[model samples]
Target: MARQPLAPVRPPCRLYLITPPHIAHLDAFAAQLEQALDAGDVAALQIRLKPAEEGDIRNAVQRLLPIARAMGVAVLLNDRPDLARTLGCDGVHIGQEDAPLAEARRILGPDAMIGVTCHADRDLAWDAAEGGADYVAFGAFYPTATKETAHRPELELLSTWQETVEVPCVAIGGITVDNAAALARAGADFIAVSGGVWAHPDGPAVAVSRFAAVLAAVAEEI
Candidate 1:
């Protein structure tokens, strides 16, 4: 058979920053977040505080939302569409266990961005896309300490989705400067990183800048 031409490259992949499961010092973390966002092309920030009181969640949002908005970065609350709505967040990210896509859509309204965690499930991705999700996420392409990940999606999943789906796909889990370029080339529209940025040895700002550099290189190659 003759060689086949590749599909047209999708738009460059951008960084999606997810907050740590816990933010011990709100002021310190907020300042770090501001620096990180200022350092690169972050598409959005997900305020994902686990086992936190509703009050803490609200406080974090109150403190961090303005910083993100000031940099033109969207703010998303993980697994809390109601809070997202009441707090005036730009969107919400829901896991398969968190809420049904339909209910989330109804709650957030048509304008809000809602992303579904499809993990490595093709059916889940398709269902979310057909159900009007702004985006579908797949991961953990690499092992992540941020959370336990049972599903490890293959790079081919991203490649195939790029060739077919109009809804953007976010490649999440353990993504860092070292591994991000491959994900970008594999067709991830956004690469979600939590520990990769926050836990970096140099600092969050440097980590963000490095990821930006990696994505830039991938964009030029494609």
Candidate 2:
């Protein structure tokens, strides 16, 4: 199927932060999150806690949502529309194996943002946009330990999606300050990072600031 072109994104890309799979100390992480937010322009924060009990997810959301919201960053829960709605999250990110987009919309309502993981498949991304997802995520663009997924999308895919869809696209998985500029120039509206920011040697704040610098540089060149 042929892809359709949409308006070009103004000022290029921004940062999207994802939580480390396990946030053992909510209070400490909350402080770290605040520092990162203060360091740069963060558009959203995804609370992605894996293999955790429902209560733990809820607790993390309860502690972190306010901080994100206060910073004017959207808060998205990973894979739990029910909890997302119940806890008043700004949105939810649903993977292919997770709940369907329709169900998530029904749970989150029209105003809430919902993003879907489309991996490296343009068809999936097209379907997701057609299905009313606020954004479609394509990724593992580089090697990543954050999660295991076989699909590794190329930088060109971002250009294709940008030229085709009005709905914004996110490039995630193993993205970091070092390699993020390529994705931005390729037309990703947002670059989602997990360990790239959270586990940076200089710390999350430095990571975010560096990413912001990269995005700014790319925006100018593109």
Candidate 3:
């Protein structure tokens, strides 16, 4: 039998709910994940495990994968391609400082989703796409308390990028449900977030659901 074509994973709607390493309640995290899935704005869940330690990340993947998979949310492990494949995550996200895109693709195989961080430069994004990235991330569009910006991308870059690249484009950096529509209008395929969902006063589940709603709202307008 011929191999079936893989269904395309669309870019995140308007809001991309991100997972952080710190969660006060494990059950709450899972519940929040369920809420995000129910909300239906999510494109993928990036499991950001910092400090690049194997045991630490493995533990995180073990805890988070079940929740994501249960909800049919694609999981992308940050910075560690090997661990991502090992943990059965759908993809790996690499920063410019992390690993090469070709390297990531080679390890993850042809069909695996691999994302790259290109910051603000259009040329960089083009390079990443040529290098075999499934998606390209641009960020620090807004000041983020979570991670300091090394290079900032201009808003116009989003429009330019959307036109240039066939691969999905992700706009990251301190995005919240409130501001996500602008990015969506600018043609971002995905909106990567870190603190927005996790740091919400309403709690993670509400945060996730809220972001999801925001994304849906944006989609309706389009």
Candidate 4:
């Protein structure tokens, strides 16, 4: 399918932070999250608690949602629109294997930000955008320990999507301060990071600050 052409200028790519699969200490993690958000421009935060019980997920959301929201970062719950709606999350991020996009939107209502994981598939991205998804994510651009990745998208995917689509695209999976600039230049509207930020040696604050610098530089060049 042919995509709509976008304007010559694009917005500066922003950061999207994802929580570690398991946040053992909600209070400590909340403080760390605040420090990261305070250090740079973060567009959204996805509460992605893997292999956790419903109670744990709820507790994490209850503790962390306010901090991200207070900083004006949209809070999205990963893979569970029903939970997200009940928990009052800003939105939900759904993977291909999760609930269908239309169903997710129906559950979250019209105003919710619903992002679909396209996983290097152009057809999936097109289907997602056409179905009214707020954004489409493409990646495992690099190897990541955060999760098991099955697709590795080429940089050209970002370039092509940026040039053709207007719905906003997120470059996720394995993005870091060192490699994010290439993705930014390739035309990702947001760079999603997990281990890249939370596990940084200097701490999440320094990681976010460095990512901001990289994105800013890329924005200037393109």
Candidate 5:
């Protein structure tokens, strides 16, 4: 049998939500995910399950993927190419600390989208592309209220990655409507957010829409 074609990359619009494993009320978050889709926000969702439980992650992904697909949102599983393959997700986002690119590629075959975390390093981005990653992720652009990590990626690095790599570059950590355009100007192809979207006082729906609106205005400029 032949493979399916990848979805055309939508012009940078909406937020990309990375779900934390600690979300106890999965149903509530499912509603939020539905809203993001309904509002035309959230281009994609990354199901990041910490502490690694394939069963639990698959359950969450199963509940979320249908909602996401119905709304035309792409769903990515973080760190597990096997699970992504089993569940037929849109992609897998792996870190430098995770599985090797070749192993992931073999499991996911040629069609699955692969995103690699390049951290703050340019060489890492180059290596990931050579290793078969579809997109590169850079992070801690602003202080993160979520994960605690020592490394902070600079805006200049975004320019460097954008210029040096063919794959789309994702800018993560503390991104919001206020700072999104600058990141976009810095040439970040995707703005990946967690707290910035899920922690907003109003709701994830509004927060994602705000980021989407910001991206829309910036896209027009470029």
Candidate 6:
């Protein structure tokens, strides 16, 4: 089947934030999220609450989505298209094991931004893009404890994808400020970060500021 070309991403590259695998306090995290968004430009936020009950996920999304949306950040829910649509999130990010892309699109409609995890396989990424994914995520470009994945895509993958694909590509997994510039230069449309920001010694705001600085510097050089 012929694939529909993805809409081009503006500004070329940006930060994509993911929540900690677990959030014990929604209010505290909401404050931190606001600070991070305030400190720099973030394109989107993924409410990734693994192992949490549906009610807990709903609560977190209700509290955090408004903060992100108010700052013009898109909110994405991980692994649950049904809840994402039901709870009014901007989109859902589906893993290889999650709902099929067609199903997710059916549930959320064409307007919803649906992203698919392609791991290290260009073939997988092509499949997702051809299947109508809004963006295709490739990772772990660096080692990560955020989630366990066997595939480790190299920096060159982003470069290659950028050269060939119209769909935006996201570089994820253990991406930190010190190393993010390389990905930005390599042509990642978005850098998906979680522990790298939340676990930074200086704090999320400082981490976001540093990442923004790196990306801005890279943008100038490009």
Where's the lowest-lDDT run of ten residues in candidate 5? 7-16
Candidate 4 lDDT by residue in tens digits, 1-222: 999898577789999999999998889999999999999999999999999999999999999999998999999999999999999999999998999999999999999999999999999999999999999999999999999999999999999998888889999998888999999988899999999999999999999999999998888887
TM-scores across all candidates? 0.96, 0.95, 0.87, 0.96, 0.90, 0.95
Tell me the tens digit of each residue's lDDT in model 1 across 1-222.
Answer: 999999765689999999999999999999999999999999999999998999999999999999999999999999999999999999999999998989999999999999999999999999999999999999999999999899999999999999999999999998888999999999999999999999999999999999999999999998
Point out the higher-scoring one by TM-score: 5 or 6: 6
lDDT by residue (tens digit), candidate 5, 98-172: 888888999999988899987787888888888888888888788887787667888998787666667788898
Each model's lDDT comes to 0.95, 0.94, 0.78, 0.95, 0.82, 0.94
> Which portions of model 3 miss their true places by more than 4 Å?
1-14, 21-28
Q: Evaluate model 5: give its lDDT.
A: 0.82
For 122-149, candidate 2 gives per-residue lDDT tens digits of: 9999999999999999988988898988
- Give the TM-score comparing model 6 with the true structure, all chains together: 0.95
Q: Over the stretch 1-222, how does candidate 3's per-residue lDDT look in tens digits?
A: 999999655454554556775555656676767765675556688988555567767777788788778777788988889888888889998988887888888888999999888888788888888887888889988889877688777778888877666878889988876887788878888788878877878866677677777777777776
**Candidate 1, lDDT over the whole model:** 0.95
List all candidate RMSDs to the true structure.
2.7, 4.2, 6.1, 3.9, 6.8, 5.1
Model 4 per-residue lDDT at 216: 88
Q: Which residue pairs in model 4 clash with each other?
A: none
Q: State the weakest 10-residue window (summed lDDT) of model 3.
A: 8-17
Residue 160 C-alpha lDDT in model 4: 94
The deviation in Å at residue 5 for candidate 2 is: 16
How far does residue 80 in candidate 1 sit from its true spot (Å)? 0.6
Higher-TM-score candidate of 1 and 6: 1
In model 2, how large is the Cα lDDT of residue 6? 84
